[model samples]
Target: MPETPKKLTIATRASRLALWQAEHVRDRLQELYPLCEVGLLTMTTRGDQILDRSLSKVGGKGLFVKELETALLDGRADLAVHSLKDVPVDLHSPFALSVVLERDDPRDAFVSNGYGSMDELPAGAVVGTSSLRREAQIRQRHPGLVVQPLRGNLDTRLGKLDRGDYAAIILAAAGLRRLGLEARIRGYLPVEQSLPAAGQGALGIEVLEARADMHAWLAPLADPATTACALAERAVSRVLGGSCQVPLAAYAQVQGGTLAVDALVAEPDGSVIIRARAAGPVADAAALGERVAQDLLAKGARPILDRLSMPDASA
Candidate 1:
């Protein structure tokens, strides 16, 4: 067995949800290595800053982890805990995602003070969300509702809704459940209506690529099923060059010996949505994801992707 770490510091974002994720990891680590002194080192990332613009308009989800990666490179943190959906598909050199813990509810939550579900919202009512994927789906399904940009931490977004900035807002069900705010979720958007982002509801630990010992220490925390699913989902994103710039969603599930993946690409205005699904043996999860991505491209996702990548698409 590898020697247990005597002391470890985890890098984390300072938001309530981010701290909750880090502390959950810390508590689990303590249980495994009772003698280890685990501490959390919280820092704000650019993702947590610049609340005025959407993440897609800025730099994508990499903004969330760049500072934490710097911490690992400089020896300030042994590992960083991240919401897996915030991790980019291609990690830069010298850094690696070491483990994926078990997943929570991988569904989108509908929250509203006046509405019981999205279907109950009146036409022209405002709906706020921080994700383009969710926005596109809403527009496709409910063209009468006004979809608006909502940028901020969980609490901040909720506050906006409470103050009448929106008639309703969409949030990750996992975050609400994790924060013990499950009652706030009036309903859940079915996967058929809104496919989740890759690795949604899961936590990933990032470590330096050379940290063999750290990998050893963290190995026990990984859930084999979740890891396989996350791999497949991320594979789809990687093949499609997915980022916040595009309204893309990939979700995977592992059951018995089979692993199934569902993915989609959409125009920002929700006018176009291309979807694909594939299933295979769990051992071939990544390949199954790639197959689905190719299927989507064949189904006309290529033009949507090409148009979005153009320099003036946002203009």
Candidate 2:
């Protein structure tokens, strides 16, 4: 008798959005390799357990991805699914991003109780979000509104707004759509008004660098356009050293075979914002990001980067 084929285990966070991403990957893999079995292994990260402090104040985006990477390294899981934005800019040598799924909306969404859009929010209204990028953009546009730190899974955060703990909350539209919660979003923020973080709205498959077989299996799922755009956004963060405390923002989009990127650096209080944009062939996506970053630095991004690297006085 022939031996049984081994099942592929995909590790993911237990959040609804994370599960949706994993399921999407599973379906795609099944279609590609009909004989292979796909299984899901859910694990909680430190970030999920500790919700009292904002992500930047605690540990930044790494909080959401570190544990899953560890699982991959330890051979406990065959692959890990991650939100591309939550991934660190500089990955360790032991692991490689095996596949980048097709991207989603790549824009931020504003969900409020009764407001039609961000502009409709009353003056002094409170908006809840855990991202410095979102908060900074909000403050830049509507200084009169109050932005407060909020932390939780999607449902938990939405519940806070429903219970009147906050008048509105900002979230990634891709996440909401994946989990069938799109109805909660009052409006999607345009990239011109609110630039998204690097690699936002994309999902990544992480695997051991030495696992050539795994890469071969996953390679077919990758989307070159999405990969190009994500790399460009990540380049800016990698050049900046991935400081979680810094008020940094980056967005990359593909248009007419060209990739256009916008990056920003700002004081935490939204006081001194510096923005730069660049456009070039999609093949030069990474270079475009670097060019934008250099422009931002020339416009005074260096001092803000320096201050963010310093030890916190409050600590």
Candidate 3:
């Protein structure tokens, strides 16, 4: 192990859930090195400030982490914590996702005040979600229901549903469980019905790529199984050039020394979807993910992806 630092600071967004995630890292670090001091440096991100427009329209999910990255760049913090799902697969030079913590539920939660499940909602009922992946899946499964753009932190989203802006809302079960708000989830959407976004429900620690010592210090928190699964899922996203502008989903799981990956590309309106699946030895997880991506592309997903990437694309 590298020599322990005397103090460590984590950069995180100021949202309640962001703080919780950062604090979780801090607590873990403190437990790992009892003599070292741990603290948090919180700031508002553009992703949090710009709620008027969808993330796909404003700038994609990178809006959530650029400021945090800036903090690491300027030495304001040693590391950053994030929801792995929000971290782009093509994260560039100088920044690296050092490690992924153990995963949580990795399933979408269905929350509604009066309804027990999505099937209970009547026609024309509005369901709010900020994810194009979730919106596309909902539209495909419940064509009679209305899907709308929802923005803001977990609390704000729940408040919107409470105030009746939406008849229901979809969220990651992990976030609610982390914040001790699991009671709010009426039911969980199975992976078969709504495949998770890449790295969903997992927490990742980011550091400057050159910080070998920093990676060493944080190594204890890494979960081997989750890391393998996440790497495989991210590989699929990387090959597909995935972003919020595209309704894409990738999920992977490791079981009994094998890794299975599932990925898909869909029309934004959910009118068309192409899916692929592949499995291989855990050591070949990334290769399996690449194979799945190629399968999706070969099975008629290329045109759907091309149409969405057009300048004035509207589905």
Best candidate, lDDT-wise?
Answer: 1
- C-alpha TM-scores of all predictions: 0.99, 0.96, 0.98
lDDT of 1 at 31: 99
| Residue range with the least summed lDDT across 10 consecutive positions in model 2 | 1-10
Which is the winner by TM-score between candidate 2 and candidate 3?
Answer: 3
Task: Give the per-residue lDDT digits (tens) of candidate 1, residues 1-315.
Answer: 578889999999999999999999999999999999999999999999889988888888999999999999999999999999999899977999999999999999999999999999999999999999999999999999999999999999999999999999999999999999999999999999999999999999999989999999999999999999999999999999988889999999987899989999999889989889999999998899899999999999988888886766665
Residue pairs with backbone overlap in model 1? none
Each prediction's whole-model lDDT (CA): 0.94, 0.86, 0.93
Error of 3 at 61 (Å): 0.4
> Model 1, residue 276: what's the lDDT?
95
Candidate 3 lDDT: 0.93
Clashes of 3: 0
Q: Give the per-residue lDDT of model 3 (tens digit) for 262-311.
A: 99999888988889999889999888889999999899988887777665
Q: How many residue pairs clash in each candidate?
A: 0, 0, 0
